[model samples]
Target: MKAVLFANTDWYLYNFRRSLAMSLRRQGYDVLLISPPGPYGAKLRALGLRWEPLPMARRSLNPLREAALLWHLVRLLRREQPVLVHGFTIKCAVYGSLAARLAGVPARVNAVAGMGYVFTSSQMKARLLRPVVRGLLRLALGGRGARLILQNADDVALFQQAGLVDPQHIRLIRGSGVNCAQFALATRTRSADDERPRVLLACRLLWDKGLDEFVNAIRQLRLQGCSLHALLAGTPDPGNPATVPEATIRGWVAEGLVTWLGHVDDMAGLLASVDVVVLPSYREGLPRTLVEAAACGLPLITTDVPGCREVVTDDVDGLLVPKGNSEALAHAIRRVLEIPGLAQRLGEAARLKARTQFDEHIVIEHTLEVYAELCDPLAAPAESSP
Candidate 1:
């Protein structure tokens, strides 16, 4: 059997869906990866899977370029003739699905990782394009033997209400699952001399990620006589329009407000070194960093938004502050610091939640089941629209 996985970038494929691709390969399928070429493309090739570079502009809106992209995908799909075609992110899910149908692929899976900039942004451009994008999504997602995988129930409901997809075609699988074994509980002892707790925010440095708010919150805490080390990890995405410039990040680091650690590969080590993990993102499909941090037994502080709320029950696994409110975030951080046993309690609960619900194996098993059902009709009853 042959399967092709399409994504917006090589980095996303290597980082998020590497385990899933390996799982499929282990199951005796010849898996092919398609994405724009990058440093990570070589890593995918090194994993012993065939990697094909597909030139795609992730944020471009030019009609001629988009037409060429669709045509390229259609031709490539026709040449490969894979049994299953899986697409990740918005562009891949939309264009890929349409291309796969045109190529007569047997089964299709479109993973809507997040609503992304178009849905998240309140700009005039976003508002104008919303209806057009919705129409395209409806057309792309409407076909036989096609399934839509959403990371959160909120996204599923939004798409359903917009008439972009049928309820039965949607599957809520949570974030790309975290490997509990790899991100096991941190076992580090702090010295008596060091009393400050380490707090971290790990995500792509995007404006929409609320980095400014996090910095302001840190400043607020410091003014109130709270002493803690704040760290910002992850690289800025040049492809994204909302990317935080390197100069801005450097300025923050230079001012001693927060330590900027660019593109951390040793997340387990980083989590082990930190007392709390925070993601004040405006929105997300599901934030993987928070889930990984939870698996590593670190307490969390995040916004009370869709993806953040999904991972944390306020005051249960973590604290949830109002989105875009730096003062609220500051207060929550102080509360976590001041309270004697709150962090410990939240970390314990988070670890339990990650192990039970967001384990990598659970996600893999569920995804494989979907693939099985798609490949063999008799394996499960056909899903119907509600």
Candidate 2:
């Protein structure tokens, strides 16, 4: 059977779900990937996977445009006639599921990675759209063949409380899994001889992501004469209203607060260069940054919110502070860096967690089982072809 996986951006397909698509192909499903046109689209195609660009306006609410986009998807689905349709993120999930229903598709899988901009952002616009999006979620996912995947228990509860999807159809899968083997490093760059501890926060540079808090915490640490270096990875997401301006990032770099390395593709190398990985985001659908850091045997510092909490057990594998509290974040960073042997304990536990829980292979298997529930269960995943 043919499977089509769709997302709002090709970057999401490349960075997050590339493994899933390849795994589906290996299991003898003819896979086709779709997203808005992007540089990463070519990269996906280069991986010997079929990738097509589709027009999707992430923030558009225009009636005619929305109708046209829906028609476009409906037409494509009718033409392609894929048996399985999987969409990532809110907009794509709603749209893909709706189109699948219209086109008479057999199995529809929607992965809402996180609550996304609508539920998380406290801005007036985001708040206004929540009820409407929730309504659409009910319409899209309430169908017989539809399945919803959430990354954490908090989200699962939120959806169930909101009466969105049928509880039976929703599944809790951890964040798109991290490649533990790739991120594994023999030793972190930080050593006793090192002058300063290096901490890295990598994510879309967004205000709600706690970018301001991270900077503020770094400033507070510096004011206390803490000689720790900070590194900011990832790029500002233009699609996100909460995106921080490049000027703001430059200002922080100019102030000697952080070395801004925008969009580092070599994550393993980057992880090796830093002693600690932090994501002070207000919330997450299980931030892969922390998982990758955990896989690298690095201690993580993040907010104690839902998605973040799933990967970290307080004082177990990683440290957690209240969301939006920079002072607490600063103290946590200091505690991890300065307390002798604490970082090692946390890092070792985190590595074990990654290997046992967050490995990509585990996610692939669970996801395929979900697929099996909806489609042909007898279609065994054969030995991976060369």
Top candidate on lDDT is: 2
The list of candidate 1 runs beyond 4 A from truth reads: 185-195, 378-386
* Per-model TM-score versus the true fold: 0.95, 0.96
Query: Residues 53-97, candidate 1, lDDT per residue (tens digit)?
Result: 987888889999999999999999899888889999887988999
- Tens-place lDDT digits, model 2, residues 205-304: 8898899999999999999988988999989988889899999999999999999999999888888888889898887898999999999888988889
Q: What TM-score should be assigned to candidate 2?
A: 0.96
At residue 91, give the lDDT of candidate 1. 79
lDDT for 323 in candidate 1 is: 91
lDDT of 1 at 144: 67
lDDT of model 1, residue 118? 80
Worst 10 residues of 1 by lDDT: 377-386
Candidate 1 to native Cα RMSD, angstroms: 3.6
Give residue 356's lDDT in candidate 2 (0 to 100).
96
